[model samples]
Target: MNEGDERALKVAVLGCGAVGSQVVRLLTEQRDDLAARVGAPVELVGVAVRRLDAPREVDVPAGLLTTDATELVSRGDVDVVVEVIGGIEPARSLILAALDNGASVVTANKALLAEDGPTLFEAAAKAERDLYYEAAVAGAIPILRPLRESLAGDRVTRVLGIVNGTTNFILDRMDTSGAGFSEALEEAQELGYAEADPTADVEGFDAAAKAAILASLAFHSRVTASDVHREGISEVTAADVASARDMGSVVKLLAICELRPGPDGQDQVAARVHPAMIPRSHPLASVHEAYNAVFVESEAAGQLMFYGPGAGGAPTASAVLGDLVTVARNRLDGTRGAGESAYADRAVQPMGETRTRYHVAIDVDDRAGVLAAVANAFADHDVSIQTVRQEGRGADAQLVVVSHSAPDSALSATVEQLREMDIVREVTSVMRVEGDAE
Candidate 1:
């Protein structure tokens, strides 16, 4: 090969699964356009998968497929490695090796990134290679790059999102049709929204992972999956949805990340994922069924939202290809992209220290004074009521109380006080209320 041909960038793909197949297809289909845009032709050196015999959607030469991911990434010819494998062990190890071998990396593994991103980012920084994962959080939404590049100069205060499609689909079905949780989940599974196992999506684990990544990027601090307070959609019953409708709201699985003040006057960040009651007027409430939306609040840019399909083979592949093009351009220019930020280095606050509003639904004896007793609990905890609705009097009365802005500690204490009252039969639901307009 001539010097010009030999210097062309070589790319290796790790994992040829659904998303990976689409990446390969796009690379081949859009080769001409991509070459023209990047100023140099990009070539696919090899693809690594667990089984070479497994059928693939993309047509590649047989010799280029390999079972050894380590060898493919460490190969001298590969200049960029795109990892689409969704796991922790070999993916992490292979990414580190690729960076060490003087190659940049782009991945779509949110689980691995949310768990051990800082470690891998540190390694990439040490090696001075670009590490991009635009596909990890909200697939095809272009959220990460906007926050990292476009809004880098602005001060971001909060990022609230409906990041998971499966949970959102199920919740939307329940709200619109009054379907039970199990029925909605079954329908989602039938339509491929919910996985067969469905633990990660329904239990809020997936949203929590995305929340940690967003909080870390928005606040310029380090936050992990363990730091997020998670509440899944499994416990969100039909009754809860009904209560939300009565109160002019809808239930959504929200991943909320905010930067607030700590006790010592320093910035404290809180990242949590839970099923919350969003007002009907909120923009996110209008987002329905398998669609994702992220609302960002910044000092300079003001309020901005990015909305689109959060997951799927084609959507995720679009993000990966975009990153691949950017990485290739950076490589041709002999430059590295921005690494992870530890700018503010703010501490992550405990859940109890975060302040918000709550909606508490209680089943009490059909008596006049029961409402007074519930109001007293709020007053005792120093949580003022924003709205109160009581209905179905006689034997089984239900009272719904929505609180004004209150400390997380006070909300918890108020719940405890209501639970201990003699007139209160049971606390049907206690959900956090968010996205109140400033």
Candidate 2:
């Protein structure tokens, strides 16, 4: 074995489930190549695991597995710590310890970042170490780097993405197979697209976390998971999917982040995750299965689309490795890569102030005056109706209305007013419309 001119950089990977095992393989198998890229051979110092005897996808080298995560980060010899642990407490404490101990940290923990990213960034900054999390959102799409670096000069106006693979798979199943929500979810669980306890994915918590991250990067704001207005796809019915199809659209769960001027003239961020209808011809509507795609709109870049495999052990590991190499190179060069750039620090706008179009389906009396009354209801709320499609007649009649872009509050108020109308029997569905020009 030839000793490279540059000293080897020791890497500690915390957690050894699916992604961890792959990280170990890449670090070992690609050592020579990675060494060339980083100008230093990157060695896997140890892997922190709960159980040393658990089965793994890749073989761990001798004497590399340990149960002491705290001690691993605090070893004081590690140069880069890669954290794949997904939660808040232990992951947060370990990452803080790693940065505090003079080690650059690379993490794919979206939850920790979205919940308390600024704290981690501050710690890394105080320690003058690099912190990169390209794998936290959109898996291997490389969206974060583009937002945080490539488009750093440009003003990013919006980031619309299908960030969650589980919901995307279920929605794609509902559209393609004409299956209902429950049946589609069951199939997703069976196929490993969704987990047995999939509340995080299906209920929009996962997408919201990703949304917070995207909003922060795209708008240079401090957006957290709690700041996001979340509406899950659990309320997405088969009828909603059918309605989308009828309008030459498709139903998909979307994480939308926008930067618009606030009342006092400073740019504000509006971040939300929900099920929305997108036109079939749109780029995002075509993203199917468990794949993820982010459509970024910026002033200088115009329009850019990032599409690829979003999740699974391998693809996500690929993103983790990308960050690892960059951080490793920085480590070897005695310099540091970019940390969080929340320098802009724009305000996060509430959901009611966000402007968007809406698709509303109402069951109303088929008799005269109902249509006029509903139109009046929309007008009263300052909501402009874009298109109206009527179905059946009399008691079984349905009035499908798509509204022009308006303040979300106005749309909600209009729906509430419609619900109180004597002629309106039921509000079958009310969904935000996206990916189509009004």
Best by lDDT: 2
Q: Would you estimate the TM-scores of all the predictions? A: 0.97, 0.98
In candidate 2 the C-alpha lDDT for residue 14 amounts to 98
Off by over 4 Å in 2: 1-5
TM-score of 1: 0.97
Give lDDT per model, in order: 0.91, 0.92
Candidate 2: residue 131 lDDT (0-100): 96
Q: Against the correct fold, how does model 2 do in TM-score?
A: 0.98
Best by TM-score: 2
Tens digit of per-residue lDDT, candidate 1, span 25-67: 9988998898888778888889998998898887878888999
Evaluate residue 358 in candidate 1 and report its C-alpha lDDT on the 0 to 100 scale: 93
Give the lowest summed-lDDT range of ten residues in model 1. 1-10
